[model samples]
Target: MNAECGICYEEYDWKERIPCIGICGHTICDRCRISMTSKKCPHCVRPDAFKDKNVNKQLWDLIRFTQLVFRKHSFQEEEFSEDTKRCSHCSEPSNKLRVCYDCCIQNGLVHKYMQEAEQKEENIETVLQNIRDQALCGDCVIDGVHFQHKTEYVDSFIESYSRFLNNRN
Candidate 1:
């Protein structure tokens, strides 16, 4: 075997060689195997003969990790929306990346809707807890657009909750 890998620029050693077969029934290294991707062989780049399920698994794992970071920091965007926000991770401009529909679906976990839901829940809970704590006087409105008779406990609760939340954020 050659002493070096063409893709990784790593020196091919005896330890790096895996038991998998190339198209010519030659033994290749793990780095080469992954580089070949879904193809049957790194050198040949065919799809049918690369029988190891682990190869696909490894590829999926890589994509999954990338999808996570993309979703997290808005670096990766899926094909679901042409809008939303740009991803911060990739150097490529927003127009250049191939946004995948499947990846977009997976990326739904770290979306703006999720953030809005959390904020709504927090706001509702804050208001409810404020009512429970009697932070408002008899004349405080839950929504500023309207007025309601809130108890002393509710007033205190709202005050305390506001301080608690302000400190937390």
Candidate 2:
């Protein structure tokens, strides 16, 4: 059974993020299914594949059972763990936080009311520095397009600088 959604790469949760099978026999998450702008399956790109399809409950139950077993096993291992490190957010006995990446991002978002409470001007330098740090960190790069754009920009800048140096000499 496919434990994760191919499109979003998120584990199929028994709740809202349930697994669904398209008419083309490709599995996707419910959220992705709902947000689908096109009638085609993202995986196989089959036209009208997801049209009038519902969540595959039988498949989802199997995936859910597997996830439960894995989590139980992980907890059992954690019980025998000797590591002293605890998660900062949850105080869980682990090096990593228990919160999911999406939750962390959502929680980190600054609302308009919070921004108004601070009433501070945007620090461009700090923002730029943060972006630079994220871009240089290989793990933080999200999109191929973003990487390509940055690469092309840097290449163009280098070429221009080389030309300027040659003209000066």
Best by TM-score: 2
Q: How many pairs in model 2 have backbone atoms within 3 A of each other, for residues 3 or more apart or on separate chains, i.e. clashes?
A: 0
Q: Once all C-alphas are superposed, what RMSD does model 1 give against the true structure?
A: 19.2
* Candidate 1 lDDT over residue span 3-96, tens digit each: 3344565643334433344445544556667566465655665565555523233333444465455644222333335543232233222432
Against the true structure, candidate 1 has what lDDT?
A: 0.39
**Candidates' C-alpha lDDT:** 0.39, 0.51
Candidate 2 similarity to native, TM-score:
0.38
**TM-score of candidate 1 relative to the true fold:** 0.22
Among residues 3 or more apart in sequence or in different chains, the pairs in candidate 2 whose N, CA or C atoms overlap within 3 Å are: none
Question: Per-residue lDDT tens digits of candidate 2, residues 1-169?
Answer: 4477888888676555677888888888888888999969997899988886688888856654664555433222334367433333223343221222232234432121333355445454453333222222222222322333232122243344335334332
The TM-scores, one per candidate, come to 0.22, 0.38
